[model samples]
Target: MSAFEHSSYPEVAKLTIPDVSVAALDMGCLPPVLKRFVEDGAMRMQAPVDFIVVAALCSVGAAIGTSIRVQPKAMDTRYQIVPTLWGAIIGDPSSMKSPSISFALNPIQSLEGEMRIGHKNAELEYKANKKIFDMKLKQVEA
Candidate 1:
């Protein structure tokens, strides 16, 4: 007998999942400059404001690095927290998440490029200086 024609198996009921409700993002919570940037990015890229906001905040945190620290308690210095932030943007495939992240991190990427160039130049200079110093040392020993 064909699988479809078999009547011995019991019918299974379909499962229904309820929709989840999420609170809307409040623009007032963000700084004026950041609010403006997020708004502009959302409008221009046709992306969600939440995505831009999260991306911007993450980028800012990465840029800050571990340079600044905050003591949560006034009296106690034992608990120190770095201002670093990590976040993830979860959405459907065509929700513009990638574009939002790229736009938000543009400034950081530019800075990184500049830093890379500077580092390369410094490395070259160090190598040249080391070569000169080695030559001088050899002459001094002879």
Candidate 2:
């Protein structure tokens, strides 16, 4: 045995992390309508374009769950895969998570407001129609 081998010496170990390759953003992955919104949102919010786009997609997907789905292959057993998703952004206190998400989802909030107004109007109309039908039924029964 060599002197170094016979002597009491510490062993040094080398560790290596594999190189990972990530593809560039493909705008085609998003619908044509949303591509513009994502681009605009990223610019307006002064955040990473990819982050903004992904967050927007996640929010929209949750909002429209079960309404739309994907069938990847004809031979698949399931009818479709629901487009539901959940996403979270973790960062330090100054990361501005709330502002970024709020900026990205402002359009959704606006649509929700419009929908609430429409629902209120529809409810009032239904109540009025029910009252009229009740009166008509009472008259017929008299």
Residue 37 displacement in candidate 2 (angstroms): 2.2
lDDT of 2 by residue, 1-142 (tens): 9997866787777978669897988988998888888788777777666766767888788678788878988899687887667777765676667777887788888998999999999999999999999999999999
User: Which residue pairs come into collision in candidate 1?
Assistant: none
True-structure lDDT of candidate 1: 0.95
lDDT of each: 0.95, 0.81
- For model 2, the local distance difference test gives 0.81
Per lDDT, the best of the predicted structures is 1
The RMSD (Cα, Å) of candidate 1 is: 4.5
Among residues 3 or more apart in sequence or in different chains, the pairs in candidate 2 whose N, CA or C atoms overlap within 3 Å are none
lDDT of 2 at 32: 86
